[model samples]
Target: MGAATFNRRSFLKGALMAGAGVASGAMLSGCAPQSASDAAGSGSDGAAPMTADAYEKLTWSFEVPPEPVDESQITQTIADDFIVIGSGVSGLVAAASILGHGGSCTLFSAGTKAVSRGGSNHAVGTKTQKRLGLDYTPDTVAAHFNNEIARQGYRMDSRKWWKWINQSGEAMDWITDIMDKAGYTTTLELPFKDPNGTFSIPGGAHNFYGPEIQNSANDGEPLLTATLEQYILDNGGSITYNTKAEYLIRENDNTGRVSAVVATNADGDYVKYEGAKGIIMATGDFSGNPDMMAKYCSAFADYVADGAGDYDAEFQFGGLMPGDGQKMGLWVGAAWQNTTPSAPMIGWYGFPAPCSDQNHPGILLNVEGERFINEDTSSVYAGYAVSGQTEKKVFAVWDSDFAYRFDTWEALGNNMDNLGITPVTADEKAAEFEAGVEEKTYVKGETIDEVLQALAEQGGIDVEAAKATIIRYNDDVAAGNDTQYHKCKEYLIPIEKGPFYGQYNQLGPAQFLCVLGGLRTSPDCEVLDEANKPIEGLYNVGSMMGDTFGTFYNFRVPGQNLGMTCITFPYVLGKQLTGN
Candidate 1:
């Protein structure tokens, strides 16, 4: 019944094709390796012949090495009571919680170390916790969840949403306590209050800006991963970095129980780590895999290009996510939920490179030249809105006043900076501002009409329509209202000032760490099959499970995602696994 004993037979049988067909089999098996001779034998007289099956199989490897390792590279095995995939927020939290619950666990990550620079921890959502003297009761949390779900037309499972909402407060408390113990000051305050208005639950919900927690600058993902890794090690747990889980070893064809996880280490050696109790699929989202994204993510389907032809680089950790867990779950007949709503935070503006600063608040115009939703809203909504526009590209237009106000405006300043604005101060930083403008990093326009004209010409918008649109926007702002778009009155400032600017805003395709729909799971984090049946001994946390956000990005709740993964569900999963 133990994973090792159960996998011993499959391991031997797979060894036959370890070098030849291992690579191909690995893709299908989700964890097998291809052998050298098998690869060579399929070739035609040394002409590098491409086998149909090999090509198909190799596509699944995502990122394959140039050559397969010799059998000599095979190495030692590390077994544990539990094996958690991925080392990001979810994986680390699971490992820490399992260890905290007195279980010996092994953590595996595709990358080296938990904090892989610009990973998930780079940016986190902030939530008000009761510990920080913020009035966040269970009812309020439930309302927040309901708000998100209602936006999606209730496409999500209400039971699971309620479960996460109920546990959110406790999860925040646990994570904050852990962070404090790890020498980081945990604040319970909201970083920025919603400019729109107070969120109301049915029965009188309180609103108070809680105390400021430690700013997660140097103390972000790196600190969090380091702290959790130390906790695991101290509690008799082991961690293996640069190791990837290939596939789950199932107990039987009819059963959903995963016996062990087969993977290859950094040295390219095949090793099977037995999961005595279960396997937790915390592998990050599938933003990296364009193929998977095209298949599963409707938003990304039309946008992603087939560049470089490397599936791994295309999907796995390639700015978005590779949808590894999503693919695995799908293969095993796991039903997916909440595919309609994209990650609230993900937007075309957040796309990396070329179109940097897309997340910054700017005037978004359709191809015909018209303002759409508020630019400061969730990127997911913005991106989706752009996708629905005439052309895939939307124009982000602004002026010198907009930039200046963005730097000094109380509510908008910090958010602008968070969206990658430079020249923090405008007083003595005039020279720096001028330099940035010259370099075209921060755009500048001398006149409102000129900026609109330039943006129209550069971004393929109708010049006349764009000019008229700006006039209408200014008129609305002067009237103290945004009748067309309903943007906040504070942001409805007239753009009559000179020195306008424009940037060709293309939709962000995938820049890694994506939030795609995931497998359906129970409130306790148990993975469910297509029939709404639980796959016993298999749990999913973090982005691996969808429907958490329901349909839309309701209100901005910081640290909600990370808080849930690192604090709430991990504790829930650990207790469930250990029968506590």
Candidate 2:
């Protein structure tokens, strides 16, 4: 129930005592009745000796099938130097690192392929940043990161944070080299700036653009993963799909050292995989587990509860990842960290066009047609504010000048190929909006009053209330100030232009991009046990890892949660394993 307190000194003490007991041919501490057989190895499976009752008492959300799975009934499929569970970004990177270092590895995934999950990966001092003339040092970013963590009510071990911050650029380089070999182009997602010259967040949003840079859905992630997957296979590494890790096998009498992993394949046949080096847990967040959400993340629990009347299908931002890895870690006496629910990177749905553009000053109204938050904030703040609102839905009302007011990703900067966004002019955007209206995808009209009526008809917004709200907003704009929300005066543009547009940014309950934190891991990504000691051969990465973050997800550094940690740490972990 409390945090584990074991450190290096205590762990060394325990190890010395166990070694002394073995040398003296005496009973080990806590092992009852002191038998010679027990002295040799406590349990039948040679694991940390535990009573049946003790094993049953392990706190976890999922049912742990009795451990020491009958090896005779099951099969020993493959043995390697390393075993990686979950084929997401972390697992693939780890496996690749091992194989690249001339080590043998076997990777298992519940899914068929590595997912193209996060929007961007964060890295400081990246080659892309240099080429794009965006100068951000690691120390500066780390300071911002530390401030963000403290501001959010979660404390981070600065040492561990520094480990990630320092190695992030190198991690990006490692991945980019792989992408380059695979003929995939990596691009940077630019940052936003306010009218008064304050930038949104330091930009490190690296995206894979493949051979072509287009607005299509395939934003280079498929190519990236495909390359990594192929490299792992071509390097004579074993990758098992549709295989679920069941339990971790500990070394001779549960010595706080993991030796092998037991898993079950799709055919219900069990397979035991022993890794000489380590076992890495990459199975992503437990957002799909309702009980886990209720126990650990109250914000998500409340959001799910609030959405009962609206819809039944819970929206999972990055597919269904049921926290298989977290459950496994918990069963093994691993301490949890970052258990607080960070705000989800909520997306505004139902409208094909993008809302929350900083340059495009718009009115954001809640279900009651009342302005809730300053729409002039960064996209992250806007999304977070909307996610916490009643019904998690809001309206973005703008005039025909919307696109013209917000054109170009120049603030963010160009990509690797010297490509900058060609601005979609207001007329072009207006035409597209009209087309969406005709296709019944949006509501638009020639006048503000007509748009308000259409919005009420289409999205059940309070028609009269919306009109009054817009009138008040326009009057505030005319007065050269926003008294209600105090948005930037520069963004206090009136919404009285003809061809007014109103679209519902209706979102469901907080759909998390990925839940971060599970088994508490050290800087090296080693999974820590009950005593704050690293489980000898067990490591954690990606969202399955903990300690890199505090309470809230830092929207201040847009993609750092994924970029700096999820993508970077695993690569660093891999190199650390290889002693590189």
Candidate 3:
């Protein structure tokens, strides 16, 4: 009675009834429902009372339904040598590699085409590790990963980390080869200067090539996924888009391996595709799964709302990551790894426009109009800028000089124009400044005092306290050292410039792609269960595997994420699968 442990007899009673496929109505009618307080009292007092009706309900039996197979009507579909689930970058690469090596495969996913256009791919800059001419050996890559893991306090599985590192280099080479063979040219070179002054391998790295170059021109995820899809078809692999893997069917005893995948298409008709050899899970992370995100990756809890869809006229949040693999794996006694270190989301550091430019230079400030972290540290710094602020909102305070620098920055020219941000001279920006102006969408404030007042009026901060905070910042800048905030020397420029600008960088929930952390797999890409045992016939590639980013989201090395996908895991998994 202590923990209400279910003995074999009790478990079997319920299991046998459930297995018989009893109707819910019949089962409910036979049971006596108790009040919530009564149930709680039973548990607290260490006694579970089963009424006569409840016992009878537990003893009821129902006939099992027949399998939905009609010999005459059912078409016999031959099993493939391998079946890959989730046709994202990793799935496509695995499928293509398998087919290229004389193995046949069928790729399945929920979306019509893989939604590679998600966060990482959409905003990725075009850069390649090889072009940077950095001295990045495979060992250095491994060390970087080790350092990352150590930094994260070993919260992730070290074994999986080693596996990914061991195979990353070859994976990069293989992806590059595939792109080249497909007529895409690998041309982009690494752009940023490594603050560490040492070359680090790019993440999810790739260079575009040929006729598909323009469409797949940028370092976008969609283009990369599309290219990989084309390669699969070109190499004799079959792809079934708009298909979802509902569950995995194991052997009769659930011991041998994954035998077949039960999938449904757009019409909801189910098909059991047997995989005689292997099954690979390449679905992206569980950021879309609100429960999973909340449980495993809580740092981005505020962003979960953005990931949810409008359900029944109410807004919900969480990863739409069906978590097909996670659910199926659990049912089959498989283990999951890297439940921590979720893929980091990029934070935007800009404020409302005409005072802000999403694509270029902008300054970030906390709710009290204080700059917390280095704004230029990483592309994700914007998202991290407002993290843990008291008011949960930040301010992007900039003037004409900031706007001019943003417009003139070469890397931002194309992006700014695309976003309809025309170049504005310093004088033009100053002339446009408004004092304590609160429009529906944009909040503009001229003087530091006016800005704080507007922010207070708008419910973003306390007006009096915010003014005092700003005055202190101005004093620090005047003294040539930001003793209070420790801001960069360059940014210490006093906000004394007339037409001083400020806008609310709302810290409300928002969704962006980039949820890290997932199933743990070995160097050969074999996914292991929660017990650290291999899930036979199951492998993982892409974001599904963890430890790609060791510790913090280190922007010191660009393209490491893409490099891992485009260059590392695909080939590693391929070699292990094909024994090449």
Question: Which candidate comes out best when scored by lDDT?
Answer: 2
> CA lDDT of each candidate?
0.56, 0.64, 0.53
Evaluated against the true structure, the overall lDDT of model 3 is 0.53
lDDT sort, best first: 2, 1, 3
lDDT of 2 by residue, 234-328 (tens): 99988888787888887766665888888888898899888888988888766555445544664554334222211112224532466678777
Steric overlap count per candidate: 37, 10, 40
- Candidate 3 or 2, higher TM-score: 2
**Which stretches of model 3 miss by more than 4 angstroms?**
1-78, 118-134, 139-147, 158-166, 181-183, 194-219, 298-302, 305-320, 338-364, 368-382, 404-445, 457-459, 546-559, 565-567
**Which stretches of candidate 1 lie above 4 Å from their native place?**
1-77, 116-132, 140-142, 188-219, 254-256, 302-318, 330-333, 338-345, 348-363, 373-380, 403-436, 481-483, 486-488, 510-513, 552-555
Give Cα distance to truth, residue 296, candidate 3, Å: 2.7
Q: Which residue window of length 10 is worst by lDDT in model 2?
A: 305-314
Q: Per-candidate TM vs. native?
A: 0.72, 0.81, 0.73
Against the true structure, whose TM-score is highest? 2
Give the per-residue Cα lDDT of candidate 3 at 133.
48
Error of 2 at 60 (Å): 6.1
What is candidate 3's lDDT per residue for 1-580, written digit by digit as tens?
1122112233322322222222222223333244223332233333344344443344211111113344354233538888888766667778877877767788887767755432222112222444444445555455665555675577655664555455555565565566666555554322333333232224333344344323222334455666788888887888887777666766757676887777677777777778888988776666555445543564664465443422111112233453556556656656556545465545353443322212112345566655565443443445555567765676655553554432332221112112212345555544444423434333555666776666566656656666666677668768887676465564455566645566665554442444665666665677777667787887767666755544445443344455565335665666557776
Error of 3 at 570 (Å): 2.4
Relative to the unseen true structure, what is the C-alpha lDDT of residue 554 in candidate 2, on a scale of 0 to 100?
43
